[model samples]
Target: MGKKETIRKKSPPPTNQPVKDVYPTPPPLPVKAPNNGRKNGSTTTGNNCASTTTKDLWDDLFDGGYRADVTIKTDNGDIIYAHANVLGMASPVLRGMLKRAKGCGEKKPISIHGVHQDAVRVFIRFLYSSCYENEEMKEFVVPLLVLSHAYNVPRLKRVVEVELEHGLLNTENVVDIFQLSLLCNAPRLTLISHRMILKNFKAVVATKGWSSMRNSHPGLEKELLESVIEEENNQKEKIRKSKEQKIYLELFEAMEALVHICRDGCRTIGPHDKDFTQNQAPCKYRACKGLELLVRHFAGCKLRVPGGCIHCKRMWRLLELHSRLCADSKVCRVPLCRNFKEKIRKQSKKDEIKWKLLVKKILRTKRIRGSVSFLVSSNSISS
Candidate 1:
């Protein structure tokens, strides 16, 4: 019998397995954080890197020596290995993506496009441990914000927003930052950027970002223009109201001075019964001296009749205002107080409305000026 030939079935060549790409261990990035004030022997390397005794383990795991379950494919085609558990726990968005990938038969590398790979690397490091470099933050803050928003990482988003607002927000970048803030849904940053743009509108308009925004986002440009015009109108309105308020306050002070002169005597003028001694001290009211001079002029001026002299007309208007505000016109010491009240009552509807509005304004101004106590006492004296 011929020796039975043993046909050895060669085992299938070893299944070709692609080599996993490993990123070099990045030095710990220095994160800006308040110091504990206690001296520690551990050297600070990079932002958020473990500075404690177990730092080596953290570095090994993050630098890809330990078991990394998922790979991140950056826009530049760099492969970064990461642990699914850490990323999933940090972000629900990432958890869902990881789950979706696992559910599929093939685990394709998660692609993060439209950003620099270094920014992606920094982002992944933050997921593993919360830390980052200051210079990198300055250079890649906007990209980080975009990534944070896309990945639904609120903490990183807030950090980037704060860094931009505090350090980078300026006339040069305000317009650009404002647009990004809206896209990222960062309200505080939006408000700050809006205010900065408004405050330096001319400078902001001159920036390249503003020009680009105007061309690309005509709606935003129109909205900002409307806001600026509205802000200008508001400022002008405030100024006009301020001037009107001053006039009303002056009228109120004049009324008080008139009452003081009629009821009690000022330094030079008063009712017939009150003493006008030359040695009396000056009145406390600010308008006393001025009103005393006006009364002296009205008494002596040959054109004392109505519609005659401007000074007399001014005095007549003052007396009319006093009559409108007076509680008791019958026995009021002010000359023509009753006669003015009678004329006011017989005034045309237009004149009546005009005087009433003036009276209302004076009273409102008095209340706002905190002179209620003084007016109350004056009313009591009249009664």
Candidate 2:
């Protein structure tokens, strides 16, 4: 009944007072269930955070296994990377060339060490993609040739040669393709291209000249000459059978007459005369006189005069006199002699009228005889 007994009684009465069971109040009826019916922090449900952690670990392991150093620098200033084995097989120079050739920017560089940039790029694309079916390739053939030679890629070189051959076959590109083929030392390409070039032999040979061709491609010069001869023969055959046979025949006769006058004028003038020889500068008095004599002879043919007629003979003699007199006089040399020039001019005018009449007669004759059997025969021989 002292202080201890009072304290004990107070504590005991506190425990027995209603004895309310203190069970957890059912977790406050969960404000909202976790999404997808997953219980928070419950092992029965899948552990998304743990799964994410496991994935991260696997990723680290996979990354570690696959990592490699594959970067390389190229001679032309290109930086690239490949697998170790690929690098081993590739030549150091080639690797550099490829990188520089491909370049490393959004805008590609123009040319590599003197080669056109687009050409090198095309080559790189072929190396990597194994295809070169672009139109740009046509203009970039020389650069491709350079690349092939440098890389020692025989297959690629062969492909370029094929493309060059095809290009040469196109009449429009024949000259340029032929030139490139010769420069690149492409024998087969040159041979194939030569055939196409022969089609325009007269125009090409005349403009480019045999001397220039000989100097540039001495090896092919003889061959080209032969081809030109063949083409000329074929052209002659065609002319023989053409509807314009009369026109062609007259032209040939005119040319022959012109040649005879030139030769006769030169012989009459004498080689010692500055105007008459190769020693004289071109376009001089002798040259003009020679050309004038040829023109006069051609005109005389249209006038229906015999080759040895007095008028033709007189015209030839006058042309020779004109050359001898006009050798040093610039004015008369350019315009020819005033009196002789007037006579030749009048004759030329009359000859032109006669030629026109003859052309009309030929056309009239062709219309009346509608059979083109001659043309067929000519075409067969020419073709």
Candidate 3:
């Protein structure tokens, strides 16, 4: 009876579990870089891929000939196909026009005023390529510059500005460009134009553009005149500084020459022709303001004295020069020992450092002293 009852009582059914995935989708096979191997995995593809995808969806649409629901027409009746998204991304002005205009679609030609077909062509190309330049591209610059400003394409405007800087600005076109720059609110272009005009003011002023500007825009002409005057003032100041620097260098050379001359007694630089041949007396020439005084002082002065001789330096330098020229250093018999090899070496080494330091000293001296004299003593020649 118990075994029959066990058979009658049924066991509870087993719970079922869903199957787990054998392998997570093998993480997208690691991307392969180019054969160059220099590029890492992170290096993005080409500009085409970027322009066609994230940064330039319009580029992809334009290339694929899709979603291009509008037509842009130039003044020459030349037609250009474009996507609204692209034009909108490039220019707020275009975006605003598209938003405001009615029935402006593929059927209706959106006339872009005052732009030539060639310029419109380049402008469209730029929106897709993000760049433009070359010899051929230069001709289109003015038109493109105008179009970029009108359309509010700042990036295109910036590129054009940099190109103008590299361009060969000349008298024929600089005035036109300057006026255009003012009209377009391009400060960099304006600045460059001003520089070109100032550099070649005579040539630039002679041009038709300058005359046109002068007659039509006198305010700008006045500004140009003011700039020219300002430039002349700047140039004059530069010349003055240059002259001052030259004088300073000459003064330094004179000082060096003077010290050398006094260090070595000059034979001709004395009042002692016979050294008082009859009486060994101080010569009367020592009391005069002439070559005699210069000669006597230079022939007898002690150069190694701690306190230096400043007043007689120039005269001494002149005498030393005469001595050097007269003495053939190879057989120099002068008491100055002009031929002494060690003396030459010592002078060279000593003067080398002094020469370099002179420039700095000159600058300091110029700053402190109001001005240095270029005038020399009338008796310098006699001395």
lDDT of 3 by residue, 309-340 (tens): 65357454444443333323344333443533
Off by over 4 Å in 1: 1-65, 102-108, 272-282, 371-383
Off by over 4 Å in 3: 1-67, 104-109, 133-136, 264-383
Error of 1 at 353 (Å): 0.8
The lowest-lDDT stretch of 10 consecutive residues in candidate 2 is 374-383
Candidate 1 has which clashing residue pairs, if any?
28-45, 28-46, 29-46, 29-47, 30-46, 30-47, 31-47, 48-131
Q: How many backbone clashes does candidate 1 have?
A: 8
Q: Please, what are the lDDT tens digits per residue for candidate 1 over residues 1-383? A: 99999999967545573333234566899765543332222233556354543443454578863667788888778999888888889888888888777423334357788999999988887776566667777788778888899999988887777777777778887888889889989999999999888889999999999999989999999999999999889999999988998999888888888888888988767878887777788678998888889999999999999899999999999998887777777767778888986897688989787877877776777789776424333442221
lDDT of each: 0.79, 0.49, 0.61
lDDT of 1 at 224: 98
Q: How many backbone clashes does candidate 2 have?
A: 3
Model 2 Cα displacement at 306 (Å)?
34
Worst 10 residues of 3 by lDDT: 35-44
**TM-score between candidate 3 and the true structure:** 0.56
How many Å off is the CA of 187 in candidate 2? 3.6
Order of candidates by lDDT, top first?
1, 3, 2
Off by over 4 Å in 2: 1-112, 165-173, 179-185, 203-223, 230-383
Highest TM-score: which candidate? 1
